[model samples]
Target chain A: MINSPERVAPDTLARVQAEIERLGFRPSRAAQSLKQERAGAWGLELNSAGFGRLGAILDTFLIELTTGAAERGSHVVPFTAADSAEPLPAYERLVASRVADGFVLTDTRRDDPRPAWLEAHRVPYAAFGRVWDDPGITSWVDVDGASGVDAAVRHLADQGYERIGYLGWPEGSPVGDDRRSGWVRATTDLGLAHPEWQATSTQSLPAACRAAAGLLDQLGLPGRSARPGRPGRSGPGVAIVCASDALALGAWRVLVERGLEPGVDVGLVCFDDTDIAEALDLSSLHQPLDRVAERVLHLLATGPDSRDPAGGLLLPPELVVRSSSKPAGNRTTRKEK
Target chain B: MINSPERVAPDTLARVQAEIERLGFRPSRAAQSLKQERAGAWGLELNSAGFGRLGAILDTFLIELTTGAAERGSHVVPFTAADSAEPLPAYERLVASRVADGFVLTDTRRDDPRPAWLEAHRVPYAAFGRVWDDPGITSWVDVDGASGVDAAVRHLADQGYERIGYLGWPEGSPVGDDRRSGWVRATTDLGLAHPEWQATSTQSLPAACRAAAGLLDQLGLPGRSARPGRPGRSGPGVAIVCASDALALGAWRVLVERGLEPGVDVGLVCFDDTDIAEALDLSSLHQPLDRVAERVLHLLATGPDSRDPAGGLLLPPELVVRSSSKPAGNRTTRKEK
Candidate 1:
């Protein structure tokens, strides 16, 4: 069996180094070779576990980066992650031979081994999402989910919906937590007394829909805490901000089944304006796919040191007010701004 | 600069050959290093744009094949051909890096430069789709589109519509011809005269919709046919089979705008039940994505030389009966079946 790098003989390393040199790469050998060959394409390794929204978002982000880079002449390579989602063997081969130029890691856990693997190999990689325990050495692009929640909250408040609710994936997800933070911030800023159980999360969309139902039950609009409903803005209207469109759509389906018109009876806002959102006219925060794609590619090609980029590029997402979430007074909001 | 085998200096060749021996590989040490480390991933360097349905079918077939391999402990890597639709530089890297365990090529054109490239580089591969001229090659899998089209025609005939038209891509597309041939043969078997003017291919959906308007105006409902006084098949229902769902949806949109319901007024069938098709509730040929993904992996891991599985594989598609296409019965061959 071939030994690990630790057990590789000195002479063998020298010979491999010489072989690598003959490949027309510099002495930084493995690193230089990898860096030089980086412009070809991105090789992402992922597996499908049915409804992988996180996977979808990460993939979309990665592809956008690659597409953007391709416009500038670089390519993106999609390498499916092994079933285990462990890429050690793959990494060893590529690093040893200086194959992939760079990488973009996604679905990073709190103590992600992927970022460390790339870091230790001196590989130039950027994480699609961020890691909390990151060593400050890794570069990553993340969504300002908090801001999205805030937008939803402000819209709901303007529409005179005092009792708004937030629904989505478990807080274990970094993004979910960020979104929740924004929700809390917005409610606190408006001096609204948010009930402790007004928010909920679940793994599946059906589960999320169920949770939304429960939240609505707990925060019943008929309780009459705030009287005198305004035109198109008052009543027991509830604003639901979801982490993803699938969840949001699922909620909308439930509402419709119960004879409640989404965007009218209950304002619904979902993230990621995927095609489904457009067909249903579900209001969403439009993530600029084109711009994101370009940025990802630029970082991969130009090098990680190219500049951290402004605010790390939190592309402003447009609050597309559709039937789900009305405007600030014209249709849904309390006052016209 | 590094030179090809023919242009290499004898001394340099000998030195490289010696290094290759040291690495337990042949020729360039780089290639040997890659071949020695086989990750459970297969590489497919097929053209995405020009490859045709044959290419897409092979892709679906491969996805099916790969699922099994993955289940058996292996993953497949999906990659596209270069912009020029060739793999010279891309293939070079794939070969030397041992990126894919084997090569699987789809949509192999008649004058394919890929086979030659593979042969010159000693890469092992399989073909899923093939150009008709390569009759002697036993390395491919092809779906009998003629039969598929026949089934579609028969299905349409079972319904009560007469007056039919074929929505197809350019004839150069292998699968397109196969399906069109099926359509024509079905009509012939029914002893009905097929009209050439009924077929059409536009640059895009909007164009197709515009053309559809004209077709509808000319072949108006039973009593509305341009040839006045002659009553067409009661209601003179029409069925359109688009080469792709995108086009089918476009046609459906046009019909709806003109106050015509798809399944009720006119029948439609599309190929490749893409995402849009499912939500739109349109009938189509369901490409077995799971089976295809599984099969590709299986062929890559077990069928090919495992050194380079960049060949093609074709999987059968399923005809999903939706409301869009009426049930056949007394339907005229001119209408559909």
Candidate 2:
């Protein structure tokens, strides 16, 4: 009678409504969920490797996702899989118990079991990374790493850095390869391609530093030049475009050790404008995480069946320039190369 | 009858159990929650400031909390307040709607409204940081920052660093002050007290670098000494104990710019062994996040009504000795003073 006011007499409806307002009555979410057969919550699998690290943007994405869910009168239930490699059991448990209406997937990689399993079970899910194994899958939103890296290279070129080197993760990872392609495309477009100027290393700082050192030597940085006899590449107008902030930190450390100022000596740019970049004053590409989160939640809300025909969205990252990418004329440090 | 097998006839129960097993039917969490008047979920408010930074440990804590909650058959529902300062409304909404049975609070500070508001409303909540305003409130589990800093100082001192200085945040924050007190206590205890050999800055890199330079100068580190006349403190056997990895990065940068290799030239130790510390190989205090999460879950499970007679728990962080704090004899870099 309270819900269907039309079934009750006008006087009774008014009295009951007034009493409810006076007593501050509110419906229980669990009871409502049961009646509607919806959990009103989304499961988010927290794979430890995705967050809690340098240059990690997933933590920021989580904040955006949580904030967005709240605005839509929903909650994000974070859970960890017992076995990260075999996460289907965790997903299945949530589904069986009806603890979540759907899931928000992240760290989507090649040959990942999640998308295929979720699809087979008719589970509603949306990923923050591309559905790498299946281009047919459209329930995802990701940053355009290739374009972001391309922009970084172009930005470095514009800053008067002639010999631009690339520092990136070893090939084979989809995301790393995608970002590397951008550097390739940008340098080729500018007719300044120096393929040998690049070097690869794992995400570790020591490894990054070693790779960066070798790359610097290849680019004809004085004192440690690997090919000192080679001509035309030796100069102060050199810059390095790194795939991640962690890699850029390695390059930055090499510059500091050589008593060379980053912007004043060698221009530097990196992807993922994380705290490391901000702290060290390095120019980096900033992913549109808020928009990505909004799109992901949209995909989750309007299941994969109702996804857009255009397929997964790839938003371009914005380049955040700091002192590291500034022209040499604006030198602040007194270090002489 | 399915749940209480003994209440039914043996034949009927056997048949029902077989059918249930065949169908793999499980009790709906939402329906169960409605019946029991429990949400079986804990709310975690993710303030942007607490995580996603150079020296943040909250992200790690979140992962640990999520894993611990899952083990206890509970979900951690992450949410964001419309106004972080007045977050009671968000908590109230969760309570009134029965979305969560309790909350796991983080970033608890003095004069925080959540503790008082939750206590008055009789809401079950446990904080990751101490309830600084009310000593009687014992629903928290915190890393003992003072003890952690004290250990770092002693560790640096043990590594043969004679002129030990501190780089910390500006005074007023309870956590910052606690850590600073540790430095003071340890330095005084070891008869190496140099009250003026310290500097404070906000958690920004540039500010930290400036402050660290000043502290290093006061400690008589080479050419930049503030008082050239001051005799006893000049040389390579100096070290800095930073309150956080972020601050340590700043000090590290200053040291790098002056061509001084860490460990070989100056010992360094910091708190919150975050990725920044790991990347730079800085020795730091690692908070027992897994243990902290376990304890926080325990507090939330055992509500304030049946709380322990003892006060809130303070777990000490372990000092992770990396290359940054090694003795000067292990010199790798060829830089000369």
The native-contact fractions of the candidates, in order shown, are: 0.03, 0.93
Best DockQ among the predictions, by candidate number = 2
Candidate 1 C-alpha lDDT tens digits along B1-337: 2347768888988898788778754132234333444444456653534222211233334435444544564434455444545566666555554445557666666677776676566665656555355554445555566666667767776775565677776678676777778778886787543555254554355556555655555555422233443233355567777777656756665564444556677777777775445544567787665654544445445543442244345566788877678544432442320
The residue pairs found clashing in candidate 2 are: none
Model 1: DockQ vs. true structure: 0.08
**Could you report the DockQ of all the candidates, in the order they appear?**
0.08, 0.65
CAPRI band for model 2: medium
Which candidate comes out best when scored by lDDT? Answer: 2
Per-residue CA lDDT of model 2 for B89-123, tens digit only, reads 98999999999998999999989999988999888
RMSD of each: 12.2, 3.6
lDDT of each prediction vs. the true structure?
Answer: 0.58, 0.87
CA displacement after TM-score superposition, residue B215 of candidate 2 (Å): 0.5
The candidate 1 chain A region of ten consecutive residues with least summed lDDT is A26-35
Cα distance off (Å), candidate 1, residue A179: 8.3
Q: Tell me each candidate's TM-score.
A: 0.56, 0.94
